[model samples]
Each structure stands twice: as structure tokens, then as C-alpha cells.
Target chain A: MKNEWPLWEVFIRGQHGLSHRHFGSLHAPDAEMAIKNARDVYTRRNEGVSIWVVEAVNVSASSPEDKGAFYEPSNSKVYRHPTFFDIPDEVGSM
Target chain B: MDKDLFQYLLRLGDNTLVLGHRVSEWCGHAPVLEEDIALANTALDLIGQTQLWLGLAAEVEGAGRDADKLAMLRDIWGFRNLLLVELPNGDFGRTLMRQFLFDAWQVINLGRLMKSSDPRVAEIAAKASKEAAYHVERSADTVVGLGDGTAESHARMQAALEYLWPYVGEMFVGDDVDAALVAAGVVPDPASLREEYDAFVGRIFATATLEMPESRFTHKGGKNGAFHTEHLGHMLCSMQWLQRAYPGASW
Candidate 1:
């Protein structure tokens, strides 16, 4: 419909220190209603400690043609892996 | 047995049970998907509260009937919900308007109940109060938004407010039952809640830019079990049909 409510992307933080992860999207008339809708749609099962909603129109996405530039380059960077580091016995599980 | 307390708990449980069912009727029929989910969530919260309230009521009655039995097996006169709650959900705006009116009263009533002399009553009130507070906030915000929005929405919300206004009084009309509860400190007199309800609703109406109806006339009798609007009987037929058809059925 031409007058449909705007779509909003929802992000939910599962715990106090956790970063919010994208959960889903829903339509709302405004930012406030978007948050309320996200709470109802995403957090009913104790799924989140917090929520964030962004308008779908305001999100910037990389195009499929730019996938190599945006993502493929990172696949070959073995030096970027933190797994190569060794810890002293005194440093324990770190 | 405390007959007055049992009656009061039925009033509490039945309000949530009936209103929850009414809200659930919008499950797949709301104006939009998000709203459908939101309304369903509201209904679920009310139904959860119903379980608590009615469970306690059943215990107080010392009868074999449980919450499910009290909720599903009861006839119209057995219900003690406010007439406001049992009224049909006219439209989306009207449903929310009815919700707002009920939630406003419930938030205050539950707030007072948190300090009830009956410990079980206090415990249920504490949990239900949180949900009622959230319900009133969302419903009030929607009322203001729709009441002050485009001409069409504003007009519809105004009409909704007018239609639901008279029913609001039934929530605060105290009688002998309230007197006994008040004497025992189990509940505050319903009449005492009027000033706060008016102030809260007045501020909301002012912000919504919707005029409150000037008339003070109220239709009563639902909560006392003296009478109910025809809507409650029709609602029970659908709600109770499954249990009626297959007695003691459960999933």
C-alpha cells in the first residue's frame, strides 16, 4: 500500500554487556512505535536486555557487485587471526 | 470461606480473562502485522494475569474448580468483569481506547493492591502492576497519537473516546464488597480512585487534543453480577465452546 507504515530494523542485546544483534524488522508509524513493536515481536521470550530500532530506509547496504571489495578481501588475511598468539602458563586461560 | 474475597477475586480474574479474549480476537485481524503481534502480546499478558488471579480465587473458594474451569465453564451471570471490558471491540482505535481506559484504572488499582493486607493479593498485584503500567503507557501514547494525528484518525479516536467514556465509571464505583475489603485493608475503596483516574485521564485527553465527554452519566451493574451487556454472553459461547464440546480437553 502507498501509505504503509515505514519498516524498521530491530537489534536486540541479549545481556548487559553484549552487543546488539539484528533480530528482524517490522513496520511502525514512528521510532517510538517501532521500539514498542520490536519489544513485542522480538523480546517476548526474555530474548533481550535492550533494543534498538533503525529505519530501513536509513540503512546503507553494500551492493552484490561490491561483495569482493567489501568482504572477500578479509578471507585471505591469516595474520589478522588472533589464534596464533601463545599465552604463558601463569596467564592461565587467557 | 470469605465470600466477599472470592467475589472480588472473580472480579479481578474475570476482567483479565474477558478482556484478554477480546484482545485475542484481533490475532490475525489487526490492521497490520506489527500491531497484530503487539495486540496479541497484550492479550497474552492479560491472560497470564488471569491465571494468577483466578487460581487464587479457586483456592479461596475451596472448590474443585480451577482457573480453567472458572474461566471456561461459567455462564454470563457468573462473570464479575466490568462492563467496559466485556463490550465488543468496535475497531482498532476503539479497542485501544477501551484498553487505555481499562489500563489507566488497572495501573492505579494494581498499585494500591501491591500493599494489600493479603499477602497473596499483594504478590499478584506486584507482578500484574508491572504489566499494567506498560499497557497504560503504550495505550495512552497511541491514544494521543491517533487523537492528534490526521483529521480522519483524530476524528475516529475522538469518537472512540466518547463511546468508551461512560463505561469508565463502572471501574470506580464502590459498594459493600469494597467496604469489607477496605475495612480489612485488602483493597482500597474503588470510589477513592476517582480523583487520580480523572487527573491521569484528563492530562492524557489534553495532550491527545480530544475533548472529554461532558456528561457524567454511567451505566453500571457488570462488576456486581447484577447484569451485563449482551456482548459477554456471545463472547463466552465462542470462548467456552471448545471445552464445552470436549469436556476437560487439553493440549
Candidate 2:
């Protein structure tokens, strides 16, 4: 019976002005139950006001194994730096 | 016992005790493992609240007793909780509905209690109100979702509301204890809670696209020392077993 539903990732917003952050994942019968389960499990301390539960399968992410090859070239691009520009003493802070 | 204070504390304690037991019943039987932990967590919160309230009740009565003793030894007639908290958790829908209703009432009740003239009661209410606020929001969200979801979900949600509706009235009906608390400004009048509770629940139900049931047959008894449900006996047996079996036993 438990196998009937899929896994979901829970994201929670601690307050009205805050962004939803990843809390944890849980198995539930559906999206609705997933949200309730997330609230019950993660927000019992009054930690969240808003919640978002997405099917785990629906989220896409860059693979950890591809990290080095995917962005190593960017680290060597010193020419991209704008440090050569000069600033007036009158606008010293800028 | 100072009948007024005793009854007041008993209501608070009983509410937590019964609700805690109801939530604990889901320990190993939740629909999913994550929910098992979730239910257990809620139960723990209620148990903690019960201890604080019952402990205070013991003190006010000058009974050289403690929370555990009050919880473990009390008979049905001694409890003063609302009937709503003792009802069986029929399903996920029913449980969520029950929680939603109780949490909604608690937020208002606790918020008012936080301003109580009694410093101790106010302090406890202030702390518990924060937790109750979260419980209300979480359960309200679930209530909305289930009520607006698929056909099967809608049916279950409606059934859950129907099963639990009769007990809703008991929540705001004041007895002698409540009346005295109101006069003393230690608690707000129960009648004053209705409009706010209705607005909060109404907004959620509207957003969920669920029609509110209009039946007005209110069930009242648990607070008056009458028991009409089978859940409490089983709940007390499990909750009190260790204490009863080994009197004075401690970890």
C-alpha cells in the first residue's frame, strides 16, 4: 500500500518575506499528503508558514561527478576581472 | 480542589492528553514512514503541554501531586476536555480535520490566555500559542488541499468534516470554570471566540472550494464528565500502564 505513492522534496518558508528553503523529503500518498507530512515533520517548532512539495522525480540538478569538467575553465579567466579600472579620490569609497 | 481553577486546568490538561493519545495512535500505522515520525512528533508536543498544565493544576489544588500522577490516575469523570479531542482518528482526513478545528480554537484561546492576569497562566499560554499557531496553519493547509483535491480526496474530506462537526460547538461553550476565568479576565469569553474562528475557517474553506456543512446538532459531554466514546479507555491503558504497573517507578 505504501508503494502506491511517490517521494517528494519539501521546501519551507519560515516567514512571509522569506524564500522557501529545502527542509527534507518524505513519501506520501499524493502531493497534498506530502505537504501535510512535511509540515508535521519539519514545522512543529513553528518554523514555517509556507510550504512547497514537489515530486522528487520532477527536480533536475547538475550531477556531482560533472563538477570539475563543467566549470573548471571559468576559474582561469583572470582577464574577465575589472580590477584594472581607476577611481577618483573624490569618490574613494566607490 | 479549588473547583474553578481545578476544572480550568483539567480542561487544558485533558485537551492535551486526549489529543496526544489520538496522535500517538498513528505511531506505527501512519500511511507512510515519514508520517509516522510526524504524528509522533505532534504527540510529543501535546504530551509536553499536558504536563505543564496538569502540573499547574496540581499546584493550584495544593495536592502534593505532579503531572504524571494526575495523568495516570485520573478517571473519566475527572477529565474536563472537550469531546472533539477524544474522537477516534478515523483516517488521515479525519485526523487532519480534527487537528485543524482544535488548533484553530487553541490559537484564539491561547492568544487571549497570554494576556491573562495570572502571570503563570499567561506565560504558559504565550509559549504554547506559538506552537498552536503553526499547528493551525499546517492543518488548515492540509484541510484546504484535501477538500479541493481529487474526487476521492474530496469525499473523504467531506466525510471527515461531517463526522467531526458535531463536536465543534463544545469547544466554545463555557462551563462554570470558564465563566469565572472570563470574569477574572484570566480567559476570554467563549462566545467571543466564534466570529474570529469562523472567519479563519471560512477563508480556508472558501479557498479550498469546499462547502461548509450547515447541520447545527452540537454534541456536548466530555467536559461535563460524560463519556460516549471508546477511544479514551484504550488510550489511558497505554498511557498509564507503566505508572500503574510500577507505582513510583522512574527512569
Candidate 3:
């Protein structure tokens, strides 16, 4: 019998239209079962309204050496920070 | 509170308590990590349901025996769970088979029990039915998946069904306690649930492509407190050791 099951990445949507945030990974035979395993492992506490499971192999990640090229360029763009915005008094709490 | 209600609560609570113990036994031994957590969660739900049933049972008994005492101190003859639960966890296949059988019965049982004439029992049943629904769904999925899976898995599942099928009769054989409760509208008649249970199990078996066992002989005795398989005594020995040894040492 084969001992190793395929690996999957779990994503959970906390609310409607919310981006599914990556929680962690687990091993399952297929995508449908990955969803079931994700339910058991990640959402036992009534945490998610929806779940998406993708094969870990199918995902592509940037290299650790490319971190500076990918993210550091955005670090100097301080205008992207919400702190730069001045809200009128009428925009209460925003 | 009548002795009949107390006895009925025992039958209900004992089933949860004993099977919770059996499921908990698989804490570290499940085939996969996901299943390990799933079984533990399932066991927790049963034990929680047991607390509700046993607490009510103690109040109805009114003899000062509380839930812990009833659960931890009882001898074999005092228990009223069905024989199906007490059977040892044979394999992954057998464990799921036992779970599917009981969860199927309980989903229907609790559905009816939630509307019990006795409000406390009804409240507990309402809460338990939600959890039992998940148990039945998860277990039934596993049963069908494995039964229709690889050749080895199919064979094992078929064997498990064969071994456990005979013990299911005791679950629905209403004794005097059940008769009184049914008459009081505190519960539905056990006979009423039989067809639904059969249909549910049959539908799953059909999907699994597994054949029903030929032996139609269904064993009975657990609900009456008159008979138990050897497994129950051994289970009680380890389960009761703490309370029996310390005699009420609490954390």
C-alpha cells in the first residue's frame, strides 16, 4: 500500500467575497478529500464560511533571493500607507 | 421523576459514554492525522452529550448518584448502552462501521428525541442532534469511500459490516423502560425508527457496493442490563480505575 498521500494547501474564507487566507497544509488523496481534511483540521472551531484546497505542487512561489526584488521595491512607497491620507471630519471612524 | 425516566436516561447516556470511550481509544492510533483529530472531536461530542444525559439521569434518580458516579462507578450490570458500542475497536474499517451504524440511528433518534415531552431531555436531544448529524455524515462518507475504494479496502469494509451487523438489533429492541417513555411521549417508539435506519444504511451500502451479511440473526441484551459481551467489563476496568482507586479525588 502507498503510504504517502499528496500534499495540499488550505485556504479559508472568513466571510463572503473575502480572500481565502492560507492557513497551513495537509496530506490528502485528492482535491475533494483535501477539502474534507481541511474542514477537520482548520475549521473545527466554526472558523470559515468557505474553504478552498489546492495541490501544493501546483502552486508557484518566488525564490528567497528574489524577496528584495519582489517586495523591497514597494517598501520605499510610503504613500501607499493609509497613514498618508488625511480624512475629513465627516469621514468619521474611517 | 419516575424510575422509568431515570433508566431511560441511563440507556441514552451510557451509549454515549461507552462509545466516546471507544472512539477516544483511537486518539493516537488513527490511520491519518486528519482522522485522529476527527475521531477525537467526535468523541468529545459524545462525552458532552453523555454529561447532559447523565446529569438529568442523576436528578431523576434523586438518590444522590451524580453523573460522574453513575459513569465511573457502575458495574457491568448497571450499564444500559447497546452492545454495538462496547465491542472493541477492531480496525479502522470496523471502527467506522460501528460509528456509521450508531450515528445513523442517533441522528434519527435524536431528531425525534429533541421534541421529547420532557423538556430537559428535549433540550439535550436538540443539541446532540446537531453533532450527531455531522458524525453520521462524516462516517457515512468514509464508509462509502472505503467500501468502494481499492480491493483491499473494499474487502475490509465488507468484513467489518459482516462482523458488526449482528449487534445492531439491541439498539431498537425496546424494553419496559422504553415502553413507558414511548407511552409518555417522552420518546418515539424504537420500532418507528427501524425503517428509516434500514433505508439510510441500505442507501450507503448500495453506494459502497458492499453486500449485506447473510446472517439475519440480530443479538439482543445490552439495553436490559441483563447481558454484556466480555469487552464491556475490560473497558470499564481501565475507564473506572481512577475514580475507583482515589474515591473522589478531583483536580
Candidate 4:
């Protein structure tokens, strides 16, 4: 029997998001199924208007053990924040 | 207060309630987590539709009954649901096949019902048609997927189609309950819907790559208030337990 359907990582672009954001993962036989599953799983409550699915195996990840060296160094860089820039009220909501 | 209109509403309402209840049976038993939720979603729609149809049916009955009482307290013989909805869910394939067939007909039926002379019938049919449209798409897609999948999947779907095809006939069997309603323009004749139903179901079957069975024999009598299946009794046993145990309990 063909068991253990592959896992797919789902991404959704809601009414508020400009880009798709990772929502969750589900098991399916193929990309089509992953899309359907994603809709049923993530969008059942009108959560998103668009969806993207990637096979879990295709996604590469850095080791969690390297968090201190990989991500922590970026935490020290507050200059990346848009708040660091001076903007007049004329810029409006931005 | 028209008995014919009341009977028509029961036929419509019971189909949704019974089928909704059947779909709800998949709450935690679907093949996958997504399906469990999807089927449950379908169930919720059916239940809501049931409330609308049965609630109106109660208003027509004029015996001081509500939707809850009409739904929970009725004896099996009093129910007017089509046999197809009351049949047990055999597997995911069977469940979906049954849904596709029913939705195919429902979408058309409700579309016509929207134009009903009676304001209430038209109102309910309008909302239901929209949901039925979505259901047709979802179930049709699933049918294509399962029918064209692996050999095992294809075989299972074919079996489901063949097994349930017989019950589909009952959806269109018309008698006095349908006659008066059709004459009054409260509802469309079930016979008139056959061609359209077959066309939609045929198209889906083609895309799914499944061959249509040659069986001409069909099971009927769901709308006649006499169900020949044991499935409804068992289903109602659990469905009515709480209502029977506590006459007026509320959550």
C-alpha cells in the first residue's frame, strides 16, 4: 500500500497580508490535494484569499541549535526597524 | 397554512436535515483531518438549512411546533427526506459521491425554488441555492480526484457510484406531494429536473474517468413518507436520544 502521504507546508495571503504567510502543514498525496487541504484547513473561516503549498521535503531549514549565532546577531540590529527613520505626519499611516 | 406547501417544505427540509445529520456523522471519522473539517462544514450548512426549512414547515403545520420539535421528535414514517440522504456513509468515496449527486440536483432545484410564488419558499431557496452551488464544485472536484487517482482509489469510487446510483432515483420520484406544489408554482416538478441532473452528473463522471453503471433499476419512496431502509432508524436513535431523555432540555 502507498502509505505516508507527503507533508505539505501551507501558506496563505489573507485580506490583510500582502504576501502569503505560513499557516500550517498537512499530509496529502500531491500538490493539488495540498491546495484543497489548505483551503479546508486554513481558509474555512474566511482566513485567506490565496494559498501556496510547498512540499515539506523541498523546504530547507537551518538547525535550531544555531539560533544564537544565526538569528540573535540580527536582533542586535535595531536599525532595520522602520521606526528608526524619521518620518513626518504627512507620511500618513505609513 | 397550505397543506400542499407544508408538505413540499417538509420534503425539502427533511432532505437537508437528514443529509446534514448523515454528513455530521463524519465529524471525527474522516480519512484525514482536513476532510473531517470539510465534511463537518457541509454538515453545518445542512443543519442550518434544515432549521430554515423545518422551521418554516412548522409555521405551515400551525400546530405550535418549532424546527427543533419537527426535527427531533418526528417518527421515521413522518419524515419526508429522500432515501439517498439517509443512507449510511460507506466510506469517504461513497460519502462524496452521494454528496455530488445530491448537490447536482439541489443546485438546480434551489435555483428554480428561488422563483417560487410564495415569498417564504423563494427566500429559503435563494440562500440554499448559493450553498448548493459551492457544494457541487467541492464534491465534483473530489469525485474527479478520487475517480482518477490510483487504481485502488478508482476502484473504490466506482464501487461507491454503483452502490449509490440506485438510491438517486428516489430524488425525482413525484406524486401528490409534488403534484400540488408543482401546480401552484411553489416548486418544480422532479421529473423536469432529471435531464439537468443527469447532464451535470454525467459531466463530472466523465472528468473523473469513471464509467457510468448500466443499471436501470432504482430505489424509490423517500418522499412518500415511507422509508424502506434501516439506516434512518439507527441514525435517529442516537440523534434523538437527548431529546427523548429530556423533553425540554436546552443548552
Question: Which of the numbered candidates is closest to the native, going by highest DockQ?
Answer: 1
TM-score of each: 0.95, 0.79, 0.92, 0.89
Query: Please, what are the lDDT tens digits per residue for candidate 3 over residues B1-251?
Result: 38999888999999999999999999999999988988999999999999999999999999998999999999999999999999999999999999999999999999999889999989999999989988998899899989999999999999999999999877777877788889899999998898898888999999999997756678878888888999999999999999999999899
Model 3's DockQ score: 0.59
Q: What overall lDDT goes with each candidate model?
A: 0.94, 0.84, 0.91, 0.88
* Model 1 DockQ (Cα-based): 0.84
Q: What is the TM-score of chain A alone in each candidate?
A: 0.84, 0.74, 0.77, 0.74
TM-score, candidate 4, first chain: 0.74
For residues B157-188, write the lDDT of model 4, one tens digit per residue.
99999999998887778888788888888889
| Per-residue lDDT over B1-251 for candidate 2, one digit per residue giving the tens place of the 0 to 100 score | 26687778888988988998889989999876876887788788888899889999998888798888889888667777888998888999899899998999999989999998888899989888877876787788778878998898899988888788888988777777778878888878887998898888878878877777787678888876766466677777787888889998998
Q: Is the docking of candidate 2 incorrect, acceptable, medium or high quality?
A: acceptable
Q: Pick the candidate with the highest lDDT.
A: 1
Q: Of the candidates shown, which would achieve the greatest TM-score relative to the real structure?
A: 1
Ranked by DockQ, top first: 1, 3, 4, 2
Docking quality band of candidate 4, CAPRI definitions: medium
Task: Give the share of true interchain contacts found in each model.
Answer: 0.88, 0.81, 0.38, 0.50
Q: Which of 1 and 4 is ahead in DockQ?
A: 1
Question: In model 1, what lDDT does residue A37 have?
Answer: 88
